[model samples]
Target: IGLSFVPDLKLANSLYALGSCYNTIALIYTKLSDHLRALEFHHNALAISKRIDNRRSVAQSYNNIANIYQDLEDYDSAMVYYERSLALKTEGNDRAGMASTLNNMGELMLATNRLNEAEKFFLESLEIKSESGNRAGEVYTQNNLARLALLKKDFPGAEQYLDITERTAQELGLLDELRVNYELRIALLKELNRPADAFRYSELLMVVKDSLMNREKAEALAGIQIAYEVSERDRQIAFLEKEGELRKSQLALRNTLIVVSLIILGLVYLQFRREHRNKEQIKTLLREMYHRFKNNLQLLSSVLSLSARELTDEQALQAVRSSESRVNAMALIHRKLFERKDEARSINLRDYITELITYLIHAYGYHERGIQTDLSLEPVQVDIDKAIPLGLIINELISNAFKHAFIDHQSPCLTVGSKLEEKATLNIEIRDNGVGMRPPAERRGESFGLKLVNMLMNELRGKYEVSTQSGTRYVLIIPL
Candidate 1:
């Protein structure tokens, strides 16, 4: 019906509406678990969204397609779609959408038994949900956390998470989340050898299931009623159109068009002036926002530093410091943007990386350890989206080297280099003159740092290779 209203199918509004319709149908099929049909509609939605230049819809289509792939157990495909969705959402600064995609990715990681990676994604989602005051989303993440804890055999931790989730889910009237909480509760009780409690939860689970079925039936009936009403409204419109056949005078139409054109021209001139002022205002606001963001990150880094200082366990302190470094890396990007006086969105990679290495050197006490630094980088500019993740990747590689790669080396040296290859790819090398590091395959199931690196690499659509012959040499190839 919406398509019929469009006299020209090539119009932007028509294409955007068609994309929305496709998205709606795709989501409906997704809920029905019809993977083939869902993917077909989602791909159509994605194509139309791209044609209309509707980025938000494109991100949503990607996320919906990822959900279908995940249901079909195509994890690799799901991950790729999820990453694309996340990148687009991040570009738009859509925090709510980002949280949703993060939660879905966390579930994918959990299903694959990458527990540590799952926890990180879950925590990230939870943090965003909490900050956005999304109580329902926060409860859902807590339930995921409970499931994660159960998998790790941390019964007490699982119970703590379930307790919070159950209470919050009920408070929020989140039926789906409450059902999930009940299911996890039953599992937790079974693991604890409390058959009676497990059985009690099983009964409650059935009641919730029945309630959900009734809610679904109600929604289905409502949809049917809406369809009937729309049909009747269309018939009435057709009847009214047949009854009244008034025609307009061609002279009046021509006069109206001339007046409308004059009005549009005047509005266009006013719009031009308004847009210029708006652009200036937006730039000023962006700089101020960047400054605030950088300051907030610095405050977070300080808190992490203070927390690390208070920690007694070496491993725990090191973990806190690693997190602090990651925060610092992200903060650096915003700081650069804040300091830049131009409207250019790209940051000079040479200056950014050189300053980053210098900070890391002091932060890790490379000088105190008699460690030598070698920095070689060609001038390249990257937008904030790529810069933040690249900065984190560099931080992790260099920080890992400083902490572990130089355990017993007499003459420690770190080499950080980057160069543009044929004006197409950016080749980055981080090498150390210390003990060789383990390959990704060996530490794939462990190492939070490596998990983060893999995720960031995916975000950048980059490839990497590790050589452990002389020491640890990480060669990252990122397309420009």
Candidate 2:
């Protein structure tokens, strides 16, 4: 019919109608999963629409072509066409077309496992659909949202969206949307641990599936019979006209192998993407855990600080302050781990130790007492297992120096240094040029801070030496 009116190019309205007819046929082929035929017809419609400068028809054609590409798993091509369709629709101020295209794009994003982008597209599409009173489109988009919520394990949100979709779809008499609502409800119920409810939905889903499948199977069987009969007549004609049976068989085998290979490659790609996404999710969760842990530690330290302020006894005040400093040290390490996006387990000693020393200096009011500080730190990454213990040890050593060594000293100097001796040994030194203390062997019993330091050292399986020659110097040796 379109070819019959081809010569009358001046009949633009007739040309537009012909374009619509071709586009309708393309959509029919698309539903039948004949993507190549669908694409060919869509292009014909696009060319005719473009020649007549009909933006609406052209946009429709582009969207249809994009849908076909999406079905074929050609995501890059689908995106390109979708963008073109959206641009044309926007220029024409076609709200309905734009909403449909956005919904299609959201579906594509969802299929590619881009949950955030999919949600954005779906929400925008839903808003447009609702504003235009497109209840069927609204139901479909809400169903998609329910599926997305299920994927994200938002059971309550999924249930809410599913309820809306179910009610609207039933009222609208949209069987396709109702079927999807049932499917999503079952999945949502299963996720929420409502197995009895899930079983009910499962039965409804099967009933819907059977009803839809029966109609589809009847249509498909009729089509297949007609196609087979036509092909059989053609095959007979070909067999009589040509003798290339072996060549045809070989060609068919080659095509089958190519298709199998493509399918295998696609599966491999999908698996790799899945693993990569899982790893990214794990990293995000780990960082969040570290952030929360750091925050809780800060809160605990603050409580300790408040408690210390209320303590009248000097010894009680000292104990609370000591606990606060220890908590602060662990919190600082967690802060560093959270800052580091690449790896969560290890932290840079340079920043970690520098910030820790600064916090300790202010905490003890050593700056007001004219205490001089020297720090020579090496850049090193240590695992959290060792870093936490090492941090506490440093906190205890420094706090001990500020309390005992710097008493009644005119010019008190605190020096801290760290070096990587050899490839596998970490050496740390904390020295205070103030009043010296007794030797480790001469000391009768250990303080709480000293006990903590000793326990941490034992945990790290490291060695430490103390020298009271000039003032008080402690050297710690840890294995990498």
44-109 in candidate 1: lDDT tens per residue? 889988887889988998999899999999999999999999999999999999999999999999
lDDT of 2 by residue, 339-456 (tens): 8866347898988988998898899997687778798999988877578889999999999998889888899898999999996899999999877888679888888888878877
Against the hidden true structure, what lDDT does model 1 obtain? 0.79
Query: What's every prediction's RMSD, in angstroms?
Result: 19.7, 23.2
Root-mean-square deviation of Cα positions for candidate 1 versus the true structure, in angstroms: 19.7
Q: After superposition, how far is residue 339 of candidate 1 from its true place, in Å?
A: 64
Identify the leading candidate in terms of TM-score: 1
* Model 1 misplaced regions, further than 4 Å: 1-13, 244-480
Query: Residue-pair clashes per candidate, as listed?
Result: 0, 0
